[model samples]
Target: MQFRHSLTRCSAAAAVVLLGLAPGLPAAAASSSTIGVAAGANLEGISVYDTADVLNDEKIKDALSSIDFNEPTKVAVFSRQGEYSDDINSETLAFAREEHPEWISQDAEDYGDYWADGYFIITLSVEGHGDGQIGTYFGEDRKVSTSQMESIHEAGYEDFNLSRWTDGVIAVGAKGAKIMNRPWYKNPALWITTGVAGGAAGATGLVVLGVRASRRKEFEANLSTGREHLSNVTMDLDTTELSARTLPTGSRHAADLERRFADFMAKYRTLFARQQELEAATKKTRSSGSGVALSKDFIDTAQQLDATDDAIIAAAALYTRSATWQEAWRAQTAPILEDLAELPELLGGPDKKLGPAGSALRSFADTAQQEVQAVGTDLAAQVIDVDTALDRLSELRKQLTERLDAYAAARIGAYAKSEAEEKQMRAKLRKQRYASTGTRSGGSILDVTSPAEFFWRVSAFNIGYQSAVKAVNSSRQAASSSSGVSTGYSGGGSFSGAGGSSRF
Candidate 1:
């Protein structure tokens, strides 16, 4: 029986070997991130080499040697000091090609099958700060991506900056191992290389898995709709701007924004365009009663659109206060602090009221409070502009809100009599949050863009609260509010090699 099971895995691995016969367009990308510190990881049996002598090499190796990597990937660190350039990305790829040609994938389509052949190559070019300065290279067998590379780079940000080079090495290795390791089921060659009886079951499972894919896809539809409605009012906002020309520049901006917003509601009645069409479609969708089931397509699209809608409404409110200056800053800043202020209610002190997750949430909350306060100081001192302050605050809001919502749901879920109820409740929370954005539009981008008021509102829409809640520097947008695709590779690979780079 054990042999049969192993055979089953081999068969799947064999089948998966054929997955990438189609050509994969090569890509190179990276991003920047800076967060507080965390502890280092153990890298016992892994092969690590420091091609560039930065000092304390043996010490780095010794600390990492504490943990065993049975898959034990080889790691090579390449360091140099210079200005930021695209060369770092290409240079890392070149090092792998020249020194470790054996590591490149024999097949062009290889994506994480031969794990043992993978290498984590870190290229550190210091005397540089922010993004794309720290480069990473992964062997074809290892298959790291742009997003994963960024996470790995971020893992070592603190240690790397302090020139605790080895500690930085250990941090990245631990992170890479954690990210690279996957279940045996992932190896297609392992599952299908053996025989027939197991192959049928495996194939069937793959097909069934494809049936109801993708909450992200669903979320996208809604976000796309919101963008359409916003764009529609572009000209109207433009007109408002023109009308305000008689006023002084700052006053014109203030008058223009106010007029644009008023026109938005007066013309279309709150974010929707062609109200009659939407009402007509609603009546058509309903059968004999008021209750109508939303299609999966409709639900996903609405969710994403609403997230954008919330950002817009939140922006509008803040824009209104933009002229009020201090009040606008307060509006931009208060929600996150208010949310953090409630942490103790859920935390219940050191006793762990919500279990391990609760404790974890509180720890993050504390960090968030300090950061928010610090930013507030910066804003008051004029050390940072309002846009910059909003960028910082927006990121904090996304992180806290997502976590708080989850913790709140978990608190509610705790009372459910069954596991199914808990899951259902979680889904209900997400669905309701996505749907709550009050973006009632049934038209396409073109349809919504038809009105003169539409053009104008979208024109001024760029002004206010948008940046306050959408941090430009975040690694990736939070899932609850982001309009990105659900998952997978973020899909970029280099023709030169498989790995991508990230900033430290």
Candidate 2:
């Protein structure tokens, strides 16, 4: 979705006059100490223009100052309030061009959408309270996995929803730093370079000897945490396996659980062996007093073991949810039935007070209800497969959302009185939707008063049957991916298809 376009570039003074925005960006003063360590000068290149005046500039600067990066990196946070091009990436890039041309490089050989070799942009646009889009464009040097990007967004989106402007901005920046900045232990490149420059044997002898003890202590501390997490997961596996053994003989759920448990247990045994090897190696290294750098390959295997816990949790929840599914199916379906029954009332009854559209809506609802109920009957009889049932239920949910949104669009405004009210209503509806299934979905289909407000809702009505579909699909990822995060993306951009409307 990347586009190539050149914008009208302007100098800072003319751009300010034309755009009518004061720079307002504070220079990050160099500090010898910050947050109990040396404050990074890396964020000193950060340009935060709170042009919307919603954020506390000083607070944001303070948060940014506390963070550091592995390289010279520049970040910009642009908070704007108004009608935008709906594509935040495009708008943000355009902002960089017209407002801060210095951020984008004029050298054709060096770039595409990214302004420079080490710059990134985060743009937030709000049209009304509780509504806005947050978009990020990353430079190659600052690129992250989609999972990491989501983690960053998760850290801030709720705050934005709550109108904690300062907190949200700070959270986004802080999370970005945490992800982009590699801790000394996690970064193998530094170790490899050091080992090569100095002798590979006991590279600790090359630097200050004090560093060896500290590094060893840090590694052990991290290893202890990993062991704790691994132990808890191991216990969970034990409990689940014991439960599986106790299931009724020939139970289908038991078979499924047993299969997954066998696969997981095999991997778990390997991890335990590797863990023992690591402990043995550490003891040897300590006894030798050589301060040798051990192979970090174990770190990867350790991470893989930690990720296995996600799959175990998913399998357990699936087993538990499947056992009592009938009750949940009935509860979730009841709301849809109620909504269908209330459709005629909403459209001014059987006399067609709302006319042809109302009649068409009723016809659509009737057809959907009949189809969904037939699928439900099959579900009750255990004749319908899970995938097929999910498909039908998901289709029904979509139609209901489209139809209801249409009807609401043609009818009243003010579904919410304020941003706070909109959030409250959406949260309450979401709660009702997932109460039986134990899953929460994002989005709103409430035909809210402002377009911006709908952004916060995730564009759906999670109040009825969709929750059932979500309840299963939600855990599917956890069950499938060991890391519980998506894998792979194009080198050119963020998401899998290299998404967003930023220009090259």
Top model number, lDDT: 2
- 1-504: candidate 1 lDDT, tens digit per residue: 999999977765544444432245211111011211123332323444454555366765665555444244666666665555445665655555577555455554554222125566666666533322555666555656566666766788788777766677668766766566533434334435444566788888776554323333333344355445446444344433343332233432234334444444444443344333333443234322221223333333433343323333333433343444555455455555655766675466332566655766778788988998899788777787545666676567566555655555555455444555455445544444443323333211111112322111111122211221133213234532332111222222435454555544
Worst 10 residues of 2 by lDDT: 441-450
Runs in model 2 with CA error above 4 Å?
A: 1-37, 83-85, 181-184, 187-504
The 0-to-1 C-alpha lDDT of every candidate, in the order given, reads: 0.48, 0.53
lDDT of 2 at 278: 53
Q: Tell me the tens digit of each residue's lDDT in model 2 across 80-135.
A: 87564355555566676678876666567654444555766676677667666665
For each of the candidates, the C-alpha root-mean-square deviation to the true structure, in angstroms, is 22.2, 22.4
Against the true structure, candidate 1 reaches a TM-score of 0.33
TM-score of each: 0.33, 0.34
Clashes of 2: 7
Cα lDDT, model 2, residue 199: 71
What TM-score, to 2 decimals, does candidate 2 have? 0.34
